[model samples]
Target: MNISPTDFASLLCSRLCHDLLSPVGALNNGLELLADENDPAMRARCLELLADSAKASANKLKFFRLAFGAAGGFGDMVDTREARTAIGGLFGDGHRVELGWMVEEETLPKGAVKVLLNLALIAGDALVRGGRLDIGAETIDGHVEIVVRGEGPRIVLDDELRGALGGTAGDTITPRAAAAHLARALVTENGGSLQISPPDAPALMFGAVFNAA
Candidate 1:
């Protein structure tokens, strides 16, 4: 519960690395195959696979930069469009998941953006069967409210992640739950609350409210 800044940073880095490993590894493998393959058609296919892997790696890095790192330069506010693009690129490539962006504001506080992106990451991951992801954010009465919903034939949200999102994970936080923990910590630090739907619920949803001040 009381993780030092350094420890939290390490956890976040671990999570990013874990998420990137698959795509990055694929890129490496694809490159190796491309170099050794001699058949013309097969070589072209290897090139296509390399391109796909490279694109996936790039997309994940972009998403993680905004979700886990300082990506919007020195500004206190971040463009909502960037967030939407990052989310869309991360999940829209294969067309396996549908993205719905409902944020009307052109920009949002950097902290709120981070919370929204991390919550979106969790919700997107919950859609194990590749479902629809809806993300919305708004500022009203000096408070920023964020919501993320994932709906599909089957949604699975791990108990640890749910607990982390609700700020009830205590000292059992792991790299897999780093994003959820980050979202909870950001909301709490901003004098707000984070909520998560029950695991057995038909759909998985995340809600967070933070003081805009």
Candidate 2:
């Protein structure tokens, strides 16, 4: 409710520490297992686990580095093709949601790639049941249009998720809600708008638009 600046900072640090503990712990456990094991095969498996965990950690850092770290490095306009490839590489699972792209002669404001990546992550999370993702971008009236569509079993569109995309968090927001809320806030802070459109049939579509200067 009412937190002083010091208390708020403390809370933020606690949250970050809590979030990182699991992966760091996994790394520690994997190292211990490697040391305890005598078989080469077992050590190899532990190394694999360590490698996977490290990649996950690095991927997340890269995602956040661009989304929340700095701006104006890529320039006033972003390359759609490169953005699509980078985002897909981080989130694509091949079998589950097939990541498809349609970026023909289109670019957006400097922060557009971050918004697109956020949309892809949100979309990928929604399609846990395996689906197809169609990503596209276009420039219309000095605004960049981006769309992410999913086709799967059913669409789950909750109010909190919608609010998460709106860049606001409610009292009962979950961890996922907070992450998405942060993403939306980052996009909105960069002068963009997010929209989630659930299909009447069996599909989910979410996207965003940012004005280009």
Candidate 3:
């Protein structure tokens, strides 16, 4: 990519800022609650709020440290097992985001992992009523594909998300949308295509395809 040191640093910092935005918001909320509270009972509640927020932030940090952070270590080939686990962990104990492995040992760039994880997180948000999610990838005859599917009651397939996935212009994406947008950009940067849609089959799908040129 011939990226300069300054550009890469800026990218890394921007990525961190995007991910930590939520935890930092929660931190602010906790501080507000602490300030408004009185008495030992209320103080204990505030402490619990602070603790929970801290734990959530910590979990995200640990997961992102591997998925996006340098700690997972950078490489052209990313471990499928590690990427799957990292995404699942970041989504946490609520929704059921399943990985249906078809092609084992499929490897992609580190940025690919980060993008997929972020997209899955957005899809998870869309399936608020709890549903089935499918995550898998394949590489055949110099071609690669990754698919993320969600099936549930409500599928939040909005315009902004579609624009980001389709590489079109749209409103400024929120933190949640940033994941999917970045995923699309990552895939495109690698000469791949991203397609996202809500199926009449009651599914929300995010798929990417890369062909050796």
| TM-score (C-alpha) between model 2 and the true structure | 0.73
> How many residue pairs clash in model 3?
0
| Backbone clash count, each prediction separately | 0, 0, 0
All candidates' TM-scores? 0.96, 0.73, 0.69
Models ranked on lDDT: 1, 3, 2
* Predicted model with the maximum TM-score: 1
Q: How good is model 3 by TM-score?
A: 0.69
Tens digit of per-residue lDDT, candidate 3, span 140-162: 67766777887887777766666
119 in model 2: Cα distance from truth in Å? Answer: 1.4
* 68: Cα error in model 1, Å: 0.6
Displacement of residue 139 (Cα, Å) in model 2 is 1.5
lDDT of 2 by residue, 1-213 (tens): 122546444543454455457667888999999989999999999999998777655655555455444544746666566566555555654446678887786566656666666677667667777777787777788777778787777556566777767644455455445445555654566577887674364677777777655
62 in model 1: Cα distance from truth in Å?
A: 0.5
Q: Is candidate 1 or candidate 3 better by TM-score?
A: 1
